[model samples]
Target: MTSGMAEDHRKPPMRDLLADAAFELFEEKGFEQTTVDDIVARAGVGRRSFFRYFPSKEDVVFPDHERCLDDMVAFLKTAADGTDLVEHACEATLLVARMYAERPERSLMRYRHIRDVPALRDHEHIVIRRYEHALAAFLREGFAFRPDGPLHAEIIAAAASAAHNHAVRTWLRNGATTDAVAAARTALASVRAAWGAPPTPAEPDDYVVVITRSRAPLQDVLHHVEHALARIAPADDAE
Candidate 1:
């Protein structure tokens, strides 16, 4: 009988070879012009080996996405119990951003290709949704006692994912500069700012004693007051 260890050794890193070959072919011939047989031929691997590595040619664009997502989930699971949920979700998203930044050129090429391809775009959307769902689950577990726990968790997850995507897309469109990670962090900061303060209670009994007048519109003034109150209020008190 053949030993399992021997068989594993004989596999010859087929997955990485196939993926590298597929990406090269896609870059050369365009995604629509590339075929599974062409990828296998370039890789010097069998068609069966190609299938064993990935279900289809399109999957080569994100060969390690599932693994990266699993890594994010594992990282999230290790976060402290009393950590801020939004901050934790942002940290999880940063893991994904770092994965892309690690291969900025390849990621930029894939991003450009995916944008023009309907199928790849759909696949990208599904992958992002999966990330969001994983983050939402983590947040829900972390903040179980919060009012509207699931909804709040989902909102934070969506915001974090959106921030990451926006940053990556911006980086790709701008020629994959070294500042991509910084841009991603900045985008995450915007999301954090959006959700940072808790909502303040509207005081119907209190008179709005405005001591000063500005050139700003009435709506702007009201908005500023609301934001100030939100900043001053305790989070749990607002809850």
Candidate 2:
């Protein structure tokens, strides 16, 4: 094999190495007792290497969030928009649920650490807000035709984030044996029921047409068509 291929084959990424080392130290020493120095030592890397991957020890505790947030944004951007705006927002939040579900043991450990550490818990709120903002931004664009578009976007975004968090946290507390992704989907469905626009009342002279993928979810079709009909209202009626 070439030198670069051999290097890739022999070692995990430095980011993963640093995260694994930090999690190990956090488990043994506890979040408060574990230091950046200890984590770098365990990883066989220098302090600089740790800093390269994480801004601080707290950042290491929640390593996957940045990538998860990016995934959420991309998903929202390309997701079949034929669904209810609230449902779309809920669907976007599932990316985070999947991330936690992918590593249940690690998620459980991180949950414990967050519960025990005030600073880590506070940091986690900040991380969660980023995800909420991404969802809201996507929804805002979808609702742009309505005068209350921004308000609608923000409310649904918060609802989606709350539902996703509720499911994941409940699963973590229960030892994560259940399906986290399925739980999130169920919770989000409630958001769709609560805030999802109703189907446009069919009018003899008014028909709304929406273009979407053949494989798009049924909810998407209902949402898009409803919103399309809603925009056809008179200017004063829209207000």
TM-scores for candidates 1 onward, in order: 0.76, 0.78
Stretch of 10 with least lDDT, candidate 2 = 1-10
Please provide, for model 1 over 1-239, each residue's C-alpha lDDT reduced to its tens digit, 9 standing for 90 to 100: 33324446555466667777888988899998999999999988678876766887778888878788999989888888556667778878888888888888788889888988999999889878989999989988877888888888888888888889999888888888867777888999977877654433485433344443777788988888876666555463668
Which one wins on TM-score? 2
lDDT of 2: 0.86
Off by over 4 Å in 2: 1-10, 80-83, 199-239
Backbone clashes, candidate 1: 0
TM-score of 1: 0.76
User: Best candidate per lDDT, number?
Assistant: 2
Model 2 lDDT tens row, 1-239: 12323346468877778888888988898989989999889999788877767898899988898889888888887756577667667877888999999989899999999999999999999999999999889889998999999998899899888999999999999999999999999988878888887656676336546789989999988888777777775553657
